[model samples]
Target: MTVSVAHGTARLSAVAGATAGDAYVRAREALTAAGLSEDDIVQVVEYVTDPAAGCGEARPAGVTVSTVAVEGLPEPGATVAVEVTAYRGGGERIATGSGVVTVADEIVYVPGILPADLSAGFREQYRSCLEVAGELLKAAGLGLDALVQTTDYTATATRAEYPHCGRPRRELLGGTGADGRPVHPGAAGILVDRPLTEGAMVSLDAIASRRPLRTVNPGWRRYETLTYKPGIAAGNTLFMSGFGALEPATQRAIFDGDLLAQAEYTYAAIAAVLREARLAGNAVVRLVEYVTPAGIADYDKVAEIRAKYFGGPVALTSVVCSALLRPEFLIEVVPTAVFP
Candidate 1:
């Protein structure tokens, strides 16, 4: 296990083994390395290649934990990646915590699948999950309209099923509502090899707030891309769009067949957008990397770039996927930053 911390965020990467016990032990050592204890942890994001490998049962009762099963991991044989957010001091209890839901002020964190019969098909399961999310938001005095960011982990062979997954989100979250007008949250869909559940087709993870959000698109000309904001800034946090190694002006992929160069270019692009939003690399709190198998082969190069770009600790998760939005694209990076 390798642990790093910066500005209260801790990232733990382990490949020693894939069991839940190994993840727990690594997380414990990471907290100690960050000079933090279990009580300081606010959120935990776990990535596993096999959902059946369950996260160890050694976690504290009230912390927010979100786990997802991905296709592969950056570490050659590693199947689990754990990222944690801990405060400088004893973190305040901003909101009540339940099994997989945590509420704090304007933020809500929910992970894994919503309680629903997996016997249904993908569309039915997705709608049921969103229905549950809507009800939870209403209970918290929020609604689907308050969503700022979302991640859809779907068990599919390709991106063809992406539209089917987005239908529910569009109906539930995109459009005019009682809230006066509607806003679409920044979203990213990753094709997972499998879900935590045996027959489940899709799993949803989200972060919502009561505050309004503003979208940021730097150096935008006109190009065909998915329907999502480049960056959504709400309160002190900036939710960035997934960036690939593409030229800023031409919007064409750069460094074909070169994973390291593409990765460096992608990071540089993300940094440029951060600067446009008046933030810096150190402000980043969380980062998710979607990579193909070839990219994973040279994972060390990516880690070296990450270590050089951010001087402090940042929670990180690297997932191996079948493919990104495009076949030529080897890596896609999603980053979120909290400002001072």
Candidate 2:
């Protein structure tokens, strides 16, 4: 079996203007309560409505921090949500720049990548972002081809223009795959409440490895033209993009406005990807469930469906986004796994 990866998350509300520090403390305490230490954390994503509230220097030095600016957290009055990904093999230690990376017993997490030129538009900003990512990974003896997954945070105001990112993305990521097509990384892109930096249009989070990255498709040709892949596998891990219960060939959503039905179809689709990766449900290490406002009513029942597919405890994080890719897509499930 693959070595276990530990995950922890917590959300907390503080007095209106001062939420970041308080929430950060509560999150650390929660992880500690669950038996995780700061050293075990390889990746940390702080979802906050307020960008000014980050822990800054107070954040764990060895962790790669991804800041997520959301409209609001799921918890009422909660200003921040802290999510952590940790490895439990007990050899996690910092090897290079403190905030840039963390090597663990089983994985390497190189998180947030944002352009220093916040004044740059989407294209320039992303170009800068990719440059830094390449530098970081290259220094680690890897390349964009080593990336297994990516998360995108784009300004809500520029959401319509975000697709333009495809041009640059196509140019940078794909190393040399079939037909000269790039073996793109699995990804999830969402609209943030505001810009990441002062005027930055986009920022990103990624996971990579020194091992050769490979695409894991469920025999679907729909992604042949797009820059995103259904899943990417590197080392012993598989990273999947957010998937809803949609007909892969026709691109029609299978279940609309029904969380349970959508959840069923979504998991089945996930099972297909797992099969493509030569893995079982028990290989899953973490999951992030993004739900739309309409899906909240049926959220509780999702657990029952999860238990059916997941053989052991799976680390989880859930967020209620302002919206999903489609009105009918009540929920989108993102799964990451380590092979057994």
Candidate 3:
């Protein structure tokens, strides 16, 4: 489907396959079918359950791609889920752009970091990733202050490690130079069984824009530890924080073990946030689903519930990960939508 934001228009599509390699080819073909050439494509996000899945090789030259490893997918035995987002107009490339690439003045891709030179440790690895992210933003002629949303993938992250995770990000991206203020971006963290990079504890990616941004938070839910808004809207695009099956008032997970129920509740939460932003589910153009090992067995059930929320075709990427922020949460859903 087509999504029109303030800077440009994006066309999104999804391709699936029995194997990662095949899915990569199909994804390219799907992008071609959607009328996007190699250079026209902006970003690709691949979800895989297997660490060996070679998603990087599938990416076209000059396009930024991020592959996330998860616990399971809705398609049984499927190794890769590919989602493509291509922009039709309005963006520029900086002279020294390196790992950070900008698309349509809205999205930025920070390539996953595999710091082979650095000693293996969570703090070191995470710090290195943030360093790279900062370099990327600088290369794109932007800074940490321009970021409106971010996503982090980690091998093993716990509530205790949450602050440690934020420490590096805040140090790098949370301050306004010469203004004495804090830059708060909408953020989401995913705990994967394994990351695409070996010995890497965490990888960071983000979206930034020059357009004005406003945080969107429903009055019902509250966060005790994490430092992220419920959602953020920039121009005509909305970036939602990851949603789980937690009760709005209680902040407790509902349907602890039931995948379908959890999926429904997650969608309900997403819808509520969308409503607060003056948007709806059908406006969504991108969806990312993270499922645990137990939840992977019921992937189809989760898909069935997803179909009930989105009306048109959406670029969907599903992955099976080891666990979530909370043990009881079987699934986490992240969505992006465009408003008129």
Candidate 4:
């Protein structure tokens, strides 16, 4: 499948906001400080406490947007946190003007899509989400059968039900291998204690491309039966799956209770993927850190750890959440590396 292209990444959570407009202004200010303007933005990711409360506002011109209602933002009292992926250089880009973006001869990024029936059951909500992605891509002359990556945001109350949602995902993202196995995307799932829209159980942000993909596993066989790859390489870009400090062999969390230790293991794993993909740490353009409440106090120290792994500047974001897929997973990371 395909995924989003990233030349650069930036975090907007550093800006404190009392309102959506205030957050937007503060975000613009922060971008200016970083030497990036709105014209460079390719995508916008916003996290809010309530979607039905109108917490999300307009984003930069010609950018794809993904707004999810989560537990909280990085800044206290901030109603929303925004993150952006900017176009730094080197790619044939196309914004379909309908939330679908593509890198010609590479991959396609389908904008944020959720089920139309917010009150539906988990299965229905999930199927509809993928269906929406399929429809949107269809309008842009693409197909969802090539979906290579996805980020699912589900209501925390339905935690146990997410695994089952995979059933619908497989049914819709249909590309069975010759071995009779399902072709799964490199997926990342997060749980939210509070949803922006009342009764909205799930929402999704996905990417797909008809281009060929090479799996970058770093010898992690545990992903063979999973719905995602450790990393997927499309042309010169690598889309890495969300990873914590878990040991793939035993399925046990490593360096438990220590945020820095966990982050180290996580970054090492990421490094392994880069090495296998023939990329260097410097190739990474974005990092999205999902930190649980337990790790927030220690989150500031993570930048130093990140520096040890990535050789250059990165668009980084650290978002605090009530909990992760597992309580022991104090932090999880998803990164995109672009080859220069």
- Model 3 clash tally, residue pairs: 5
**Model 4: per-residue lDDT, tens digit, 165-250?**
87886567656433445556677888777765667788888877666666677787888777678877666667888989989899
**Backbone clashes in model 4, listed as residue pairs:** 2-209, 9-315, 50-196, 51-196, 52-196
Kindly report the root-mean-square deviation of model 3 from the true structure over all alpha carbons.
3.5
Per-candidate RMSD vs. true structure?
Answer: 4.0, 4.5, 3.5, 4.4
Q: Which stretches of candidate 2 lie over 4 Å from their true place?
A: 1-18, 30-36, 88-98, 176-182
Clashes of each: 2, 1, 5, 5
**Tens digits of per-residue lDDT for model 1 on 1-340?**
4454543444454322366566667777778876778877766777777878677575566677778777776555676766666665534343332344555445666545453768887777888777777765665677776777777777546356556756776677743323343346777767667767777777777777656676655756432243456677777677877788877677688788889898888888788878878887887777788888767778767778987776577657677886776567888888887777
Name the top lDDT candidate: 4
The TM-score-based order of candidates, best leading, equals 3, 4, 2, 1
Q: Mind sharing the TM-score for model 3?
A: 0.85
Error of 4 at 41 (Å): 3.4
* Model 1 ranges with Cα > 4 A deviation: 1-18, 88-98, 114-117, 174-183, 219-227, 246-256, 307-312
Candidate 4 C-alpha error for residue 196, in Å: 2.8
TM-score of each prediction: 0.81, 0.84, 0.85, 0.85
Please give the CA lDDT of all the candidate structures: 0.68, 0.71, 0.68, 0.72
Per-residue lDDT of model 3, residues 35-119, tens digit only: 6566666676777767685765656665666667766666656777777666663255442334437557556555544443345
Weakest 10 consecutive residues, lDDT, candidate 1? 174-183
When summed lDDT is taken over every stretch of 10 residues in candidate 3, the lowest stretch is 174-183
